[model samples]
Target chain A: MAMSRAVLEGRAEDTDGRLLLLDPSDNVLVVRARIPAGETIRVGGGVPVPVPADLPLGHKIARRPIAAGEKIVKYGAPIGTATVAIDLGAHVHVHNVKSDYTPTYHLLGGEAGR
Target chain B: MTMRGWLRSDGRKGIRNTVVVGYLVECAHHVAREIALPFREEGVHVIGFPGCYPNAYAERMMERLCTHPNVGAVLLVSLGCESFDKRALERAVRATGRPVETIVIQGTGGTRKSIAAGRAFVAAQRAALDAAPTVPMDVSELVIGTVCGGSDGTSGISGNPAAGRAFDMLVEAGAACIFEETGELIGCEHIMAARAATPELGRELEASVAKAARYYATLGYGSFAAGNAEGGLSTIEEKSMGAYAKSGASPISGLIKPGDLPPRGGLYLLDVVPDGEVRWGFPNINDNAEIAELIACGSHAVLFVTGRGSVVGSAISPVVKICANPETYRRMEDDMDVDAGRIIEGRATLDEVGAEIRDLVIGLAAGGRTRSEELAHQEFVLTYKSFEPIGPACLPAA
Candidate 1:
């Protein structure tokens, strides 16, 4: 095989595309491109999955249901905790998954995120 | 579609045409510059490492890089007091049939005298290259490397994935692509290992990442920096996944060290984090060091993705900048080759942006000027380091 597999889907369709699911064992999918609304994305297998809105790359997508305050598993490691309950294929990013351990910094008037 | 490439005497085909200058020690840097500076009119590119310390790996890297297919000629500058094996370096370049010359500053008198002698050497070298015929090149002959610096949350989203698309196209065209820094790959080890062509290669991949983890843990830093926290990344592994995507979707053929050339076409990983207990302070002090290592590995050109916007390029190879953040792109479009941030703006598709990157690589290989090159962003730096060779496990079949 190759060093990494192309998603059954690829090249983010809109402003946001799918993050990568490097392994089937991975609980969270690393977004490959920004996900835009009104486009089909590959949620995992079977068919091209659709999105609610744009989800940026490097952000995670829920492979399964996750509860509020539950650890958000990505690449099998806890990237953060879900600030709110997450459903299958939910977009998991700073707005949703907040790091429980490391404190995030923000510049005044600059807001601290992508 | 398949592409053609220029074959070198050393049996490697390069994606771009480059000229390199070698500085034997920190003291001769001024002379080396004065030598190549006059030839700036003729696409005579200058690259060299300034080091007084004698390093086997350093010397070998220089030889290999000098003989790389991208390079058409080499000029070595020595101050006469350093330990760099100038004679051996010149011999290696000469053996490749690429014109090579060395000027000793002390023997020639001083900076002014050496500059005159060096300028003469550079003139002759450029003249020879001018006489060299341009061949129709193919994509399979391309050897490209990717790395990210000044990364922010946007980098992984827009910049890196766009590069991944470009990588996929280049690989499909039969190019040899490389992605590196095992320390960053710690969390993604299992994913990286599984892609190995063989189980033995998988084991080596895992071990390299493990070594990086241990090394970084000792240094009191994760590969993910404080800025990454400020930018939205949570862990080193997360950062690695972003960087790793730059390798594209090609099947990996083998594992190679900093100066090792790929035995065949496909993707390879450059284990920049040294083997054994880390003797060097940091295997690479900054991004340019990593860029230099990529050049040494036979990379004809490099794709650099940035979310925070870094503006440096390497001396020997061309650098193509891919910007991820929309805001950053707006601020740095003049510096970037691909405005991948547009992908995040809903204006461009991943495939569209990726194809642009692929076309840009071909354009650059066909002699189009990259923004980095046009700006003359020729930066080079090297330091002392020791590395034991990789065992047989680091190959495709092994």
Candidate 2:
């Protein structure tokens, strides 16, 4: 098994070169075959990012300039909206985005529907 | 490596001996509950749907479930005002050679009067069921279904895949295996369609997922649960990729609406989304309703996978819970069976965890009690909804 959290355990490889980007919606794609880190593979005819030695089977990789109000498309469906503008090739998730449900400060976390 | 079970004439084995007190519609739900409440210690479950609208799909589902091998006897309760075919359901139960009785609420007088009558009927049925001889059976006769609730990112890689392995093992052993909630299999339709046993069946598979997507899209809630986002899932499509893996690699044999049993079984998808307009908002309002659909499809037990962790068990069928995330498992250790998160943590491999789950499936099929069953956790819930009958391609080749 590979390392879980990319931030904590993933390391960029400096090996061979091959680049593949999934759909316009997906942030990442499978290696299809192995590629060494630091090797650059052009994606969407754009300049390639260093083959970050650490790519897992289903990990995410950024595609578009996701704006705050923009929808994060994957499998080409709207999952949720971005809370802040995210640069191209940047990781987009909770730290940069939030849910549609507003939080009520209840001293502690209030259970949903309470 | 196997265990023993009791075989029913219908070619199914029961892990637990039970009698289901079924209400044909909502009018009789309370009466049936009052009937079973007094026999709570006897493993009698009050299970029923409260739909007055006549649905052939729902009617057939109720019949198969009442005659399921797990049920020792059945008592039908009706409101007399509803459209549910009470006579057909009772006859179906009787044809299985299972003792059955029917009591109408209006016909029997009022609520208390009907409750009293129903209670007496259950007591008598309980006595008769005791006389049913235990027939020796094996794991090959078992059938299990699986579903995920409170899913997060971990569920796809962990519990879902592990349960898929178990389903594979059970099917290989000649035991029927089922997995449902077509609403969750949206984005994987093309891949899912290719796995159908036949091209026609593939089309049915595609339609089911399409219906689910359209239904949820209308509600503006893809099955991309909010908890999934917190657990690292970024998009509904990503979440769907994980959910799609639960069906294992079997060629889908049929597509059945709620309450429709697979004629035979290779792998079947239980389409829980409503057929027509979204009358209920979501076909299944909660997890237990999904579990109930599995029961309606004649599943003897359910494999419940959780990432955020759901501890609910069913009223009649047993739920073997598999936790996907190691951290969540650590927090809710008492509620789970196998931990698939071990693979990501380097404590186990997918193949290793898969084999372990297969082993547990056989063990449970052989009558080894699941934790939910042991805890006497019989959580039952039913609600009103309508579903249309399936298309021609829905069932497999004759």
> Which candidate leads in lDDT?
1
Q: Score candidate 1 by TM-score against the native.
A: 0.81
Grade the docking of candidate 2. incorrect
For each candidate in the order shown, give its overall lDDT on alpha carbons: 0.73, 0.69
TM-score, per-candidate, Cα-based: 0.81, 0.78
Model 1 misses residue B285 by how many Å?
1.3
Candidate achieving the largest DockQ: 1
Task: Residues A1-114, candidate 1: write the lDDT tens digits.
Answer: 121233333323432233555455556666555667666656545355567765554455676678899876643455557777877776655556664433333341222243
Candidate 1 reaches a DockQ of 0.14
- A8-104: candidate 2 lDDT, tens digit per residue: 2222342112222323344433232334456565444466555544332223445656778876654344445677787654445555544332211
What is candidate 1's CAPRI-style docking category based on DockQ? incorrect
What's the true lDDT of residue A78 in model 2? 49
Among residues 3 or more apart in sequence or in different chains, the pairs in candidate 2 whose N, CA or C atoms overlap within 3 Å are A12-A53, A13-A37, A13-A53, A14-A37, A15-A36, A15-A37, A16-A36, A27-A61, B26-B50, B61-B259
Model 1's alpha-carbon lDDT is: 0.73
